[model samples]
Every structure is written in structure tokens, then in C-alpha cells.
Target: MLGAIYLSQEINPHNVMVNQETKVEQEGQHFFLRSKKDFDLYPTEIRIQLGGCEYFILLNGRIDDREHLFQKLSLDANKSVSDTYLIGMLYQKFDLEFVNFLDGDFAFSIWDKQKNRLILAKDPIGIKNLFYSVDSGSVIWSSAIRNILHIVPNQKVNSAYIKSFLLDHPIANESTAYENIYRLESGEFLVCENGHIKKDYYYQFKIPSITYRKEEDYFQHFNQLFERSVHNRLRTPDNRVSIPLSGGVDSSSIIAMAENINKKDNWKYNIATYSIVFDEKEADERKYIKSMLEKYNLKSTVVYGDEDWNFKIDFNVLKELDEPYPLFNRALASKTLSAAKRDNISVVLTGHGGDHILHADLNYLGELLKKGKIINYIKDLKQWKNKYPLHQILKQNTLDPIFRKTRLEYPSWLKKERFADMDLSTILTKRFEELKWDSKTITAYFNTIIRQTGHEWFDQYLSNPIGVERRYPFLDVKLMEFLAAVPPTLKIRPANNKYIIRESLKAYLPIEIYGRTTKGNHSFLITKGFKEEWNRITEYYDFKILTELGFVNGEEIKEYCERWYMGYRYDLYNASGIMRALALEIWLSDKQDII
Candidate 1:
């Protein structure tokens, strides 16, 4: 991806602006650029000089194959294109709002000489990352944090908010692990000129409550949007596709739809389904997986994930992730990505993000209470008792919402005495502090959908090296917009969650697949991976990174590690904190010459 900078007068004239690739600018320091070496012919860097003024633009992703925006810019259809045409259109189009008019996964920057401004933007969903640090009067931006680290070599790790990272997963704000370094929020366009910076949000996604009396209308509209989302992702080289299947409703739904589309289409690559399996029946989900395979006559690849656990940090993995992340599913993702690469697959369609958007939440019952629809609430409560008892119904549907305890906290492990003694946040950004308990209806669930994801950073971050683009239909803009407008009752009806999906897709999906209520369990599989790799993980575990920051309880953690593998010690060895600690070891110890 693209990494760039607009140099200011405050820079050490002969110093920070000079690099292996940087040339001494005769006048005020100009643009500096770098691109990852592996993203095919995508623009590494592009520089254009007009009227004695030099300009540069670098793009780190593919333009959409569906939209011919480049054609309007007088360019060829491409997997990768330099930002020349886009930069030209900025001045020609004369509108700073041109970004939202296009679609693709990219993080790009434009250095305009005449205007003397550096503009940086990320794609709509935040799939691509752009981070910046404005110091010494210069605004430095890049696709990766490591590149910006070049300017501030001794950037202190922001241990103050490590609690936020461990709990919410993504920081969900401008802050990064390093001091003064901030990530560009998704769809934000930043313009920095003459020591001043201004930001504009290019997209807004909000949940609005709307309902239709005709149920078929909702189903038909959803199907059209769903198909288009899948179709847009298939815009790849040779239509190579792979699905990571769990036989759950979401993945199975994608498979069912894709199989139907494939059967009726012209010459297209046959889709492959990859299933992570185990020798133990509790862990293996082949029985649930088999119904779809038998129905569709599809090709399948089964691999044991936990059998050979790869918990030790690989050098390549260390190099890929910019920060320490506790994505425990890295082993499964990396292994599957390697397989996709071997099979020449260019895009892997996933069913992540479906749970949050598709499945309705019990929190919606709060809406019924607020609206004073007591009779409907009682009827739904009767159906709720089919699964949960009255006490749980009261606690989750009423008491919790009334008390406004809707916010998810750091797991029990993070609350241990070791962590309590250390300084945590008394002052938190609004997001970290509390939730809007009054809006705990479907809104709470929508917020939850965005917080965490099975489509983890490892899956997206490792894609460049492995040459696979993992696309989630569930996160599609059109699909989400449709879901946002759907009434919560349509999402959850009686005892069924994702009521619309189950009811709408029953004809296409296998009977067993559509009717299945409980999802497959992976708790044993995950614990097994940790148990097998405990020694090797703890042996190389250096406590210096934590000690240097004074943020970790080294003695407490060491004690927990000694006993964690023996049994379930939730607070002592919380899975979240342990995995994060292991990942942090690699991030803190790295001495790579990145800058």
C-alpha cells in the first residue's frame, strides 16, 4: 500500500527528509513515497511535475471492476492503477467530495504542489489502513504504522490504553499504540497544508428503524442486494473463489447462494469450500457440513487445524502486524491463506459480520417496553422461554437495559488484582466509557456488530503476501443499509433469530442447514492449540517489553502461565490477555530496520 509525506519548512533540511529513496529537494522539501513490493503492478509511487511544481500520488488497492470511473478519467480497466488519473480529476472535478463517489478497497494520498496541500483518504469500510504523525511542521502519512515509525524512531508504546485495545479489539479511535501517532478513521479524508490540518468524513452509516407490511418485499430486496454483493467480489482474475465453511447459517447461506448462481452461469471457476476439522467429534463439524456438500455436489477440502498447532510467532507474521494483536485464530487463518495461495485462488468469500447484521438481539425487547407494547412483549417473552428461563429474560431484556449496563467490559482476567493495581482509564473516550443504555434496542446490537469480528486483522493483514482477497458479503454496504432499515421484529420473531434469513432462504438452503439453531463449538479446539504450544510460547516470552512500559504484572502473569494449561483459570489466564501478551512479545522485541 501507499506511504507518503508532505515535507514542511521545520524539517531538518538535510536530515529526516533524506532516505535511501528520498532525493534532496532543491526548494522546500517535496513529497516522499513508498509502496509495499508485493501488490502486483499497483502504484508503488507516482510523481508528476507541472509548471515547475512537483506532485505525487500513490494508491495501494484495486479500482472497482464494476465501476468504470477510470474510463471517465481516460484510463484502462485494471487490477491496479496509479493515482495520476485520480489526482488529475481532483482539480478537474473541483470537488473534494469526489472520494465517496467511487468504490474499492484502497488507502491513497495526493500531494498537490499548486495548492501546497497533502490529501489522504481510506476506503469506505476501513478495509485499507492509513496512519499519520504530524511533527516538525510536516504531515507524514502511510498505509502501515511501521513506515511512520521511521520519522519517530523512539515512539513510546501507548500503554495507557492497552486495556481499551484488549477489550474492544480495534482502538476505534484515532489513537494507536505509539504516542502522537493516530490512525485515520474509516472514510475520513485529511488535508494538511502549511502546518494546518482539516478532516472531513466522506461516508456515514447509521441504523434507521423502518418497516414494511409485505414480508416478501423485504426478502426480494435483500436477495437482490446480497447477490450483487457477492457478484462485486467475484470481479477478480479468472473468477477464482474459495469459501471458509463452518456449516453455520452464514457460511452455508453464502455457499447455497453461490452454488445456485454457479449452476446457471456460463464458464466459471468451480468454487472450493475449506473446512477446519478435528479428530474429536465435539470439535469436528462435518455432519452439519455434509448436508450442503451433498445437496450442491461441490468440491471440498478438509484440514485439521489444531492437530499441528502453530502458536509460536513466525517471522513473517511478526513482520506483517504493525501492532501486538491477540487474534488467536491466526493459526487457522494463515494456514488457510497458504492453502488458497497454493491453489491459485485470488479471492476467498467469507460469512463473517453476518451474526451482528443478520441475527436479531434480545435487546430489541427493550424497544417493546419503551413503546408500551406489553402484549407483544409477553408473547415474545413466552417464545424466549423456549431457550432461556424467566430470570435470564428479565436480566437481559429488562434489568440490564434499565440499569444501562449494556457496555461490554474487559474479560474477568483483565480485572485481576495484578491489573487493578496498575493505572487504568478513569478518563476514557466516550466509546470506551459507556454505551447509550436508552438506545439499547437494536442500536446496541448494531454497535456490537462493529466491535469484534471473526474476520480478524490477521485475515486482512496477511492477504498481501498470500495474494488472497477475503471478502465478506455480510459487510457489504448495500446489504447493511437494507438490514438497518429492517424492523427488529423481522430480524427476530418468536424463538428464531435471523428470522428473515432463515425464512427467506429456506427454499435455496438445505433443510437441515436452514433449520439448524445451535452453532458449532470451538472452545476445546482453541484450548487445545494453547495447551500444545504452552511451553514454546512461554519459554521465549520476554518480560522486558512489559517491564519497560510498567504496564504488565510480570510476576502475576508468570504464575498464571505455570498453571494455565492444567485447567480453566479464567481470571488467572484469560485467553484474551494471554494471546495479546504473546503477540506483544514479537511487536516490542522487533529490531527491524523499517525506517
Candidate 2:
């Protein structure tokens, strides 16, 4: 949650410390430091010896000059606080033995003067932002890519990354929108010494052995673990919390559990919930949300959407995101987080990882069925074949590459003839080559982070103005291990995705949500809104810049935009590509003088 910049210069140690400290304090986090050696006879070291040589630099987010607990602990020598603090404190205590013990959303760097080395690490989930680059003779770290730009002037756009980002939304792991700048992936650490960088993984997710002997046993264990995860997040003395309630199973389950805890403790804690409602009926789910609120007696607020928020376009919302991200239903979460900041809420709980991990999409079950699980396959086919309508199930086999190729062919509305000179394969192949990583490694990296840490990258990067702290009980390490232990068949049986989770929460959640067949489909909503805006914007952009830039074929780009608005969903791929290209053009135009 804090931004830090560290530099060691042989030319001037004092000047370097002063400059770094000033920058750190300007970032508005507490700033303190201890020298490697004492200069004055009275001891320049700000040392409080707790039977250890580890020097502490404490920063208070909420208070100033509060009673120092470490001082008190030094006096008592045996008193105990929560294990969470102990985990963080021990890293500072046994500096050599345990240089990296961290939890929660944090990024820290440990510098060992004795060995003339430095180690940098991010939270397992990457809820905190950290970026680094080494050039000439110095290593630089910063919380924002812009901050790094302040010190390193030669930064340039990585054109290959730009192509991949245009094809996909968020740049994949370790790749930044900028070329030379690189992000430390989630659950990873970097050790730098003697001008060499070594990267290593500190955490990995593993499937656990199933121990539940009966249905009730599974239910009991799940309930206990679920409650513990919720309780851990609610440890703050003040029980006021916020949940982004969409009337979905994930958010509803969290709200219900938190309310239950408040009731049990005889606490009059306020649960502030927020939801977004679009003007269009197909996009709005406010009616269902109202039902859930009435059932739970929860106080809630709604932020009505305005189609005419001109600032949405002016802000260049896509460029502001930490990575290239898919539209994510047109950035509703960004708007929600903006409102939450206005309300002065610090921590918000979300139901993000539940669907991905526990209630994987029903298609996963169909894949299992295709791999030949007889009864499960038959049941899934009968229940979802009509609803989801998988082509693989209809053919009783996986789709051939030829069929996939046909599906990938550009539509006629896109004007393939106009774009015939553009070599898309060359672009894609160049992106793959630039990544310098195999598809399997990329897939494994994503899977490990999601399973272990949930979608921390989204929570960390998306929340702006000031960052929003987010808690994901579904991605709690204990919960993931438990879910992984359950057989995949039992987890997604009888055409019910997240079968085990649904059954466990049956008593607590509304029956309507549990029995719901369709997930909340927001593509139509986003497509409708984007089509209109894209049309209006492209008219100004196509003539004003696209033709002049020469990187994009302006007429072809216009056709692509029209095809998208004319109700071609696949055309979004092309539309997104143009959007990214336009964004880059704007960025370069603005920074043209700087270059």
C-alpha cells in the first residue's frame, strides 16, 4: 500500500539518503531509517535492541507518535500479539534467517550492507504494486511506472507488447505496457547483487488429499474454514465494512456470513453495500439486488449510471489501468471503486475468485465428460446442452483445428479485402517472440496465482485515486486447498457448477440464486454502450490521426468500427485492437515533445 524508492550511490551516501527519504515522505507514508554503521560516538543508529541487531523503520498509516508496541514488547519480552504481526515482525527480527516473511497486500525490500546485496519481494497475490529496472550502474524500484520514468529517461514503447495488448486487454505476466519496464510477477521475488538478477518463486498451489468421509463431513469442514476466512478479514475492531453486492452467489454469501457474525457478537455494525445500475433494462440487475437487500435487512446504496459521463472518455480509462485489462463489462468496478473512495471506505470485500476456482464455468464439466465420465457426462449433456449448447458435446468430440480456423476467419462485415495487406500472423508471431516465454509457462503462472492468491492484480491495479484494500475470502489459502482436495466431478456434478459450495451455503443464501441456471451475462450490456461511444469517437479519430499515423489503415479501421456497432460480437476483437492503437497514438502525440 506504500510506494518506496531505494538507491545506493557511491558518489554521495548522505545526499542519496536525503533524496530517497524526501521522495518516500512525499509519497505520504512514514519515513525512517537506520544507518549500516554508527557515525557519532553517541551512536547515529536509531536502535532499540530486542536481543537482535535488526533496525526497524516504522510507518503509521492512521496515527502519529502512538505508543511504540515494539518498545513495549522489548520491555515485557514475553507478551504476545496476533500471529499476523508476528509474521511481519519476525522478518525484521531474524533479518538473516528470515529476510522475507510477508502477508497481506505489501511490497518490501531488504538491503543487507554486509553482503552488499538487496532482495525485493511483493505479496504472494501482488495486491501491492512494485516495478524495477536496472541500467548503467543502478537498480531502480517504484510503485508506479510513471515514477520510474521520472528517473529513467530513455523509456520507450515496446511495439511487440503493444500488439499483444491490442489483441488481449491486459498485458500478460511480467510484461508492462511500456517496453523496458518489467513487473515482478505475483508470488515471485528478485535477488540482485554484483550486477546479476535471480528470480525465484516463493509460493505454489498444490491439490490437497481429500479427507472427508461423508457428505456431512465435507459440509462441516467447509463451513468451519469459510467462517475462519471471513473472520480473519473482519479482525479490525470497527465492524463497518463494504461489499460490492451484485445479488450473485459470491457477494450474497459474503454479506450473509458477515451479517451473521455481527448478529452473533451482538454488534450494531453497519454493512455498507453498493451496486451499479445501467439505464438499459438488459444491463440493469437492480430489481434482483433489491430483493436480496430486503431479505437480509441490509442498508444499501445505488450509484445510478449516466450515459453522458464525458469524463469517462476524457480520462483515457483504459490507459490508466496498471496492465492491459479486458473491458470487464465496461469498467463498472472502476466506477464503483471511485464511489467507495468518496464514501471514505478503506477495505472492501469482493466475490471475485469464487467462480474461477470453486464454481468453474460449466464448460469445464463438459470437458471432463468429453474425456469420458459416463454418468456425469450424460447428466451434464441433458441439463446444459440446450442452455450452454457446446459444439463439442453436440459432435461428441473436440472441435478440429480446421473448425477452429473457420471460426477465427474474419467476418465479411469486417472488410477482409481492405485489410488484405495487413499481416496479422506476423503481428501475433512477433508478440510471441517478444514474450520469450512458452504458452505452457504462461498458463501455469496464471493458474498458480489465481489458485493461491485469487485475482489480486485486478484489485491492486484497478482501484485508483487512492488504492482500495480488498479482501477475497474465496482465495484464502485454506479455502483453496480444501476446494482443490474435492474431486472435480463432485465439485461440478449434475450440471451444477460449484456443487459443493452451493450445497454448503444452501441454508444461508437465497434459494433463487442457488438454483439460478445462467451466470450474469454482461457482454450485451457492454457491447451496446461501447458500440455507440466507439462510433462517435472513431469519426473524430479516423480522419484526425489514424490515416496520418500509417500504422493503421484508417478506412479498414472505420469498417471494423461499423461492423462492431452493427451487432458483430467477434468484431470486438478488431474494435479493441483499434482502441489500443488509438490510445497509443494519443499517448505518443501528448509525449511527442518529450521524445
Candidate 3:
């Protein structure tokens, strides 16, 4: 498990030493390697030094046809036994385009001494993450930002990034919280040489709707793709797998599919389903979880989702990921990763990207307008109005195109006048703005989830702490491509969202599970956690660091928190606002050295 790669133009003592503890291994000139020790991972670390070029591949998950591809490459090129097929194939191609054929999560870098060029790439769906920072003619990259900061300790925090975090979530695409450092977006590859840096994206999600006609054909196609994704994810020699089941259709459907996978293939892998239990009955889904466990006779592990958990206040522990993330969901995810590691489960499958991928937004109407399907748009608008009032529907569906070009959302946030420099040019890269204007409705929706939410890096960071890999079957490139192409009629029609998934998995999934129309309300859980954690949070509530750095107004934030806990005005959004502030204060406090 080569966890990260640090590259420099000329290695210095500070850059060579990765951390205080682990001794760094030299891979080539100006390249140092580090990996998580003593963990069983598949497609084990591949490193080759070939003909003035050095190639390295690290895996947290297995490639679909790793063995088959290796054999094919070896035979096709007549490569020697000592040679690595992955490197050989890339060298034979003499270009980075061959990375598009990879089918699993990976981060690889090729250093060509003769050509004086280096390329770093990640998987197409961004199941993997690669962060790079260019400083003093050196390209420093690692899977984690904390590692990069260890070398370039003088880097300053980007104030624009913090303001953007307050307005929305993390900065989309490549920009990090620190200047001169950037992460590669999904399907993006970086090329550096001759004092010039270039980045390019290899994959763009395009829905191939016209290719399939029958609804049943789409269902069968979806079933096949999902089964393959599940199967590919489970290709471990350990004969064990972990699934975080929530008793909802997404996770439950994965359970049903995994059951069918073992039965059809005659495999006997032990499947473990981990679920979170709460003190309150409403927050629990015992009834639904029980049925799936009994139906498949699977092993179960339960972690108490305590309402009084104050881990969010413990900045000492929260700094593990070094991201100002709202920690509500991390409660379950952290426990699941730990359970997987304890059980020797190298791979954990979750239903994270399911909602975004399976559920189509109402914005498809905007796309209809672009296509000049005015009659169809009106008909759909009436159905939408039946569910929601005309105002909400029209504002969301009809006004998208006008707002897309005429104005962006930044002006609204800037009106608050809470941040410095009203301009967003420093915060967002030009590529992100281009993506916003160029994308259609379908691409827009996917981009919001994959990039805007920081799903790739956040998911990668969560698992890295425990040395386990996270896979979202819904984010599987094949499944998403098909889902992207299918018409809105298949996605949502006659007031049914995710119509394709519900219909396709109808026979396999429990009717009660697939029939669920509303999502589980965690407001009660959040409210409970909020009340308990607030008491402990205020004990050490200090925003001196943020206010001193001009990231926030200290007095205003404290007043906001006081009003929230005193019941002046509070809801889910307010609670989230207080938590983000708390997270930011804690985050900035930890970075006092740099700030």
C-alpha cells in the first residue's frame, strides 16, 4: 500500500524525510515513496524502473481485469518476466492515454527522465485522489494534504477558500484550502516538465439515451452493470466483504445483489453488514434491517450512534482528516472503517453516490427547454405543480437557463458583505467557471455531487485514516454512464423518482424497502446531538484564531451560537450553520502555526 508519492525537482533533506516516524524509500531521482505498512491490499504495489523512466502504481482496491490485462499486455508486447505489464503497456503507448482503460481505483505516476516529463493520474470516477502542489520548480503530490504541508510548512491558508466554505461546501475541482496546492478532479491527469505544467481531463459523462429503446432492456443492462461492479469490488483473496447497510433501497439493494452474486457464482465469501443504532425509536430502522439480515443470513455488527457524542468538539481527534467537515455523518463512517479493519476487511462498499446518481433532479425540464420541447415541458410542469406549488417548480426548473448565463450564485452570497474581496476569481479556478457555464442539466447534477461536495477527496480521506478502501457501486463508471444516458421518463415519471432502480430491482429487493418514498429524517438525531454537543462545545468555545486571521467576525458568531442554543430561532439549517462555525474555529485553531 504505497499511500503517497512526493516528487521534487531536486530533493532536499526536508523533502526526502516524509514524516517524523516512517523512513522514506527512494524510487528514483527526485521521487520518494511512502505507503501504509502491514495492510493486506489487492493489486499489490507495482513499481518499475525501466529505460530512463520510472513507473509506480498503488491500489486501495482491485482492478476489474488486473490479471487478464497484465497477461494480455505481457503476451502482446513480448515483455520479459522481470518487466511490469502496467508500466510496459504505458511505455509502449508512449502516452498517458492508456490510463483511460483502467477500471478500478488507483493513483499512478510516471517519471520519464529522457523526456523530462511526468504524469500523475487517478481513476475516472475519482474513487482515488491525487493532490499536487508546485513550489520552487518541484511538483509535490500525495493522497493527503497533511503530507504535502509537512514539506512546504510555510504555505498560507487561502482566505477565499474559507469564505467559500462558509457560503457553500469545499472549493470545487482542483483548488485546495492552501494556495499553490491543488487536487486533480475526476478523470483529470497532470503533466509537468520543462518548467511548464499542464492538466487535462480524460472522461466526460455523456448520457447515451438513444442507444437503448426498451425499458426492460435498460433494466437488464443496469442489473448486469451493477452486478459486475459489485463483483469487481469483491475480488479479494480474503473471501470477505463489508457493506454499510441502512435498510434503505440503496444499501438493501446492494445486499440483495451481493446475495445473488454469491449464489450465482458459487462463492462463499462472508458478508458483514454494519448498521448504526440510536436510542430513539424513530431514528432506528430495525424492522427493515432485520428482514435483509434474515433473508441473506448475513452477519451483523451494530455501533451505537450516541446522541451525546462529543467527538466533534474534540479538535485533537477531529484534526485527523484535517478538513472542516460537518461530523454528523462521520459518526457512522468512522466506526464502519474501524470495524472493517478489525475484521480484516480491506474493502467496504457504501451507498454514498446512490442518491445523486439514481435520483434525477427536476432540472431536466431546463434541458427540455434547451431542446425546444416546449409542449413536453409544459406537461411536465403541470405534474410538478401538482406536487409542489407553481412558484417553487417554475423558479427551479424554468429559471435555470436564464440564471445560468445572466448571473451566478456568488452575488447572493457576496451581498452579506461578511468576506474580503467581493470577487471570486481568487477562490474558484477558471475551469470550474467553465464547467458551470458549459455543462447541461445532466452534467450539472453529477458535477454538483462529485466535485462540489468534495466527494472524491472527502471519501478518500475518511478511509485513509483506517487503511481501508471505500467503493460506491452507484459511482461505478459503467452504471453512471448508463444512468446518465437513460431518459428522464426512466429516471422519474408519474411522480416516481428513481423509477428505473425501483422497477429494475423490484423482484430482488423487498417491496417495503424499494417502496419507500421519503428519506429517513435525521433531524431528530442531529437536534439531539446538537443539544448535547453544544454544552460541551461552549466549554472551550474560542474563535480568537479565526477572528485574528480575519476569517470571521468572532462576536457575531458567538451571538449566533448563543441564539441557536437559547431557542430563539433554530432548525436543521441553523444547526448546520453553528456546526460549520464550530468546525472552522477548531480547524483554524489547529493551524495556528501556519495561520
Candidate 4:
């Protein structure tokens, strides 16, 4: 939503021409700023002069705590607080550490003329995106990668990124698909001073060691933090917001919390619900969705997901995506956004980060065993046996990590020669090293801060074409920290995942909605789409871009796809690979068109 260029001393700042999308522009001695209209209610960018230091800020999302910050910083509370103005005041007061006080889905850049310093930072949870490329001492940054690519065409592809994408893992650093272009990671910042660029974390994930002895205390804390997150994100024009209600606990819990807040505080807001229905029984959650609607007496815009899937590419949306993505249920996601757009809704709240933050798996069982808690481990094991077969639980939680040297299952179609040096498996290993699996706190941290960062950016950018900003209440930093600090037992019990969420919202949610254990499996939609468009998929493979790029074995991939198509048995892994291969080819073809 915003882009800026800090030119080197040699290049004339006046020669820089920003993109046409820039609604607001500011040029300083060494920097030229351009930002799009993000929120109609707030200015896109703010410029202020304080203590002989010229300051400019471009923000993509609102700072949720700006009002509190105004009082803390002793600013004029009567004056309206815009996102940019509040951040400017914070910087003038707190200096560089101003980033730590921010809480929201935002990506922003701060320019200080007095110090000749330019600082670029992303939010702690990375719900918003910030990408930059440093060339010959000048730096270019933007919320959208396409803007940076438009300025400096990045033709050279990064093989590491390709490997990560194919394997469905993050690149483990700031490297993007294009060489020399970098994405700022969550809680990270880049500082340009004295013609030198230094990168460090403005926020670090410190798992709090404090634990409340009572379960009620944890429940009370969660309700407060989560309600605050939802309330903060609901700050839109006229208090109107849209939600993607899937009938699952994550999305359902958000609505329940919001409704509770509305009734408790005597506040009013409009919530439009959008849902994707399926003809296939395996993929349908209509029964549960119906329960949610009946319980709340709310109507929803229904999207027929089965009718929506096809192997067609929308170049307009595809080109906007900076990299190839094997998006889970693309049709469903697109339809949801389109529905929100049709309703004239600007903000769409999603329940994405719940599984990452709240649902800690049985891996914590392994941790309990490792920590010499034999008695506790036995009790936990007995509880897990009720849900899963005893053999399966032990193999997954205990045997797998100890015996397996590497967690990655290298695809046979991947060219070893092309990725011979990249240690992709070490991605998970490194995270485990930094934070051990001694508790579900560490497990939840791994699932969220480490693993879910890529998906956060992908979801945000996916809504770009539809012009709807997607917000995640579950990814709230305060709520995440609370869940991470709680005992693993509170997260995963004998037969339930996200035990705390299910238990905490008992008053707000109906038993049918909260007590449900299984989630709707939409993977069937992937294979169903692939089968429906089999001929077109084959034709796409004929393009041979992956083979030309030396990243895949063309014959092997074709054979694998043929086996999946002809075989009667369902193979989830093969289905996933075929989808990713097709996605990569489509992206490559789009790249060729651009070239």
C-alpha cells in the first residue's frame, strides 16, 4: 500500500518517478515517499517537523493502541489521532525503540532527515508485508512487491526460494523469489545510517515464564485479550466489518467473542458473514454453519465452492502475487473476498492463526517424556489413547523425532543437482534448536511465529485484487503470548485440540459449535478440481518451464501425475505435489508473458 525510495548521494532525488498508484508523495533531501490510500478515514502519510528533525511515516494498517499511546506520550488527546501522526509522536518521544510499543497488522517506514536515517519495520505478527531491495547504497521498499519490481525489474530468480516453495516451507530468511529483493520478516527492521544498512529485530518472541495456578485465571485473561484484539480490528468506518464464517471453532469463536462484546458493552456494529458451501458431502460444513446461523439468526452469502473450481488463471490477480502459491481452496478464498467487496465491506476478519496459536498438537507429549515427568507423561498418554490409537500416538510424538534425522520428505521429482547445496530440512531443525519442544508453549510458538509467517503475507496479498483488507484476530500479539505461556495441557487435552478455546467460550458459544472436535477437510476440493480439469493440467505441463529451469524432472513429474490420475487409491501427498507443480508452471508462464 506504500512505497518509498531512499536515493544514494550520487543519484538526484528529483529524477525519481514513483508509481501512479501513489496518492500521496513527499520528497526530502535523500528520500522520496509514495503511499496509496489505505483507510479513507486516516491520511495515507503524515509529515511533521520536531526538534529540527523532519519525519515522515507511511502506514498500511491502524495502530490499535494509538489512543492509549496518545495519553502515554502526553499528546493532545482531543486532537484526532491518525495512524501516521500517532507513530510520528511515538518516535519523537521514544526514538528507535518506538517499534516495541506498536500492536496491530501494519507495515511502516520512518524517515528522519536530521539523522539521515531511514528505518523500515513490519508488525510483530507480520499480518502486513514490507519488502525492500538495497542497491548501490540506495534502498527501495513497498508493501507490495510488484511496485518494487516495477521500479527495479528483478529477472533473476532465487533457487532457494523455489526449493522452499515446492517443499511448502519458508525460505528461513528474507530472500524472496527474485534475487536481490528481500522481504522484512515479522518483528524485524532495517536501519540505514552513515551509508550502512543494519538489520535487527525490533521485537523478539520471549515466552513468559509466569504461569497462573488456577485455570479460571487463564480463561479470564484469554477473554480479555481476545476481545480487545477483535474490538481493535473492528475499528472501521461506521463500525462495519465482514467475517468469513466457516462454522469451525476458530471463526465461530471470533464471532461469539465479538457478539459478547457487543452485548456486554452496549455497542453496535454490522457483521456480514460469508461462507463457501460444497456439493460434495466430504467437503461440506453446512450442518455446522447452519447451527451458527440459527443460533445467531444471521444470514450469510453462500458460495458454491464445487462450481467455482477450475484450472483457469486470472492474469490480473496472478500477476499481483509476487510468487507462486499453492493456495488452499483458491476459489473459496476468491469468492469470499468478492462477496465482501460486493457488500461494500473494506475489512474482512479471518480465523487463520487460531490453529497455529491455539491448537498445539501431540508433539508436546514428546516434550513431557523428555523432561523426566514420567508420572505426568503416563496420565497424558492415557488421555490421548481415548482419541488416537496408542501405537499411532507414540510413533508420532516420541519415535519420529528421535529416530528421524531430517523431517523433510524430499520429492522424487525434485532435481538434486539444482538444490544440491540447500539444506532445507534444517529449517525445522534450527527452530527446534532455538526453542525446544519442552512444552506446548514452544510448540505453539513454532507453529505460529516461525511456521505461519509466510501464510500471513500470502493471505493479505491474496485479498489485494479484491481490495479488501484481511485481518486476523487470532494473530494478535498479546493473545498469542498468553496462549504460548499457558501449560500445554490447556491447549491439547486427551481428545481435544485448542482445549482452552473450547472451554473458555462455553458461555458465548453453543455446545454443538464449541464441543466439535473434527474440522471440515477441504482437501477433497483440490483433487476434485484437478480431476475436473485434467486435460488443461496436462497441457500446462507440456510447457516444460520447470524442466527448463532445472528445478524438476519433467518425465518423473508427469509419471507421478499419471499414477495419481489412473490409480484408484487416494494419495494426499501426490495430490498436493500435483497442485504445486501446476501452480509453479502457471506462475512461470505468467513470468514469460511479462518477459
As a whole number from 0 to 100, the lDDT of residue 437 in candidate 1 is: 26
Residues 1-595 of candidate 4: C-alpha lDDT, one tens digit per residue? 4445554456554555554333222343355667665322234555776677778777777788767788878878788767787788788888888888887878888878667688888887776778898876568888767777766774577767777677654543588778888989888988987778899998766666757889988888888888899999888866778888888999999888887777766768888899988878777888888888888888989887776654544534543567766663556668888898898897888887787777556666676777778898899888878888999878877666444454445677787777777776444423342233555336445544544455555554567656787888988878877877887789877656788888788887877887788878766555555566678667776538888878788887776667555543366656666567767677777676333
For 88-139, candidate 1 gives per-residue lDDT tens digits of 4643455476676666666778777667677888766666667898776667
lDDT of 3: 0.64
Q: Is candidate 1 or candidate 2 better by TM-score?
A: 1
Q: Tell me how candidate 2 scores on lDDT.
A: 0.53
Q: Candidate 1: global Cα-lDDT?
A: 0.64
Candidate achieving the largest lDDT: 4
TM-score for candidate 2, please give it.
Answer: 0.73
Clashing pairs in 3: 3-35, 207-485, 208-485
Give candidate 4 regions above 4 Å deviation: 2-16, 19-30, 38-43, 76-78, 170-172, 310-312, 315-320, 391-396, 399-406, 429-436, 439-457, 563-569, 590-595
Any residue pairs clashing in model 4, and if so which?
Answer: none
- List of clashing residue pairs for candidate 1: none
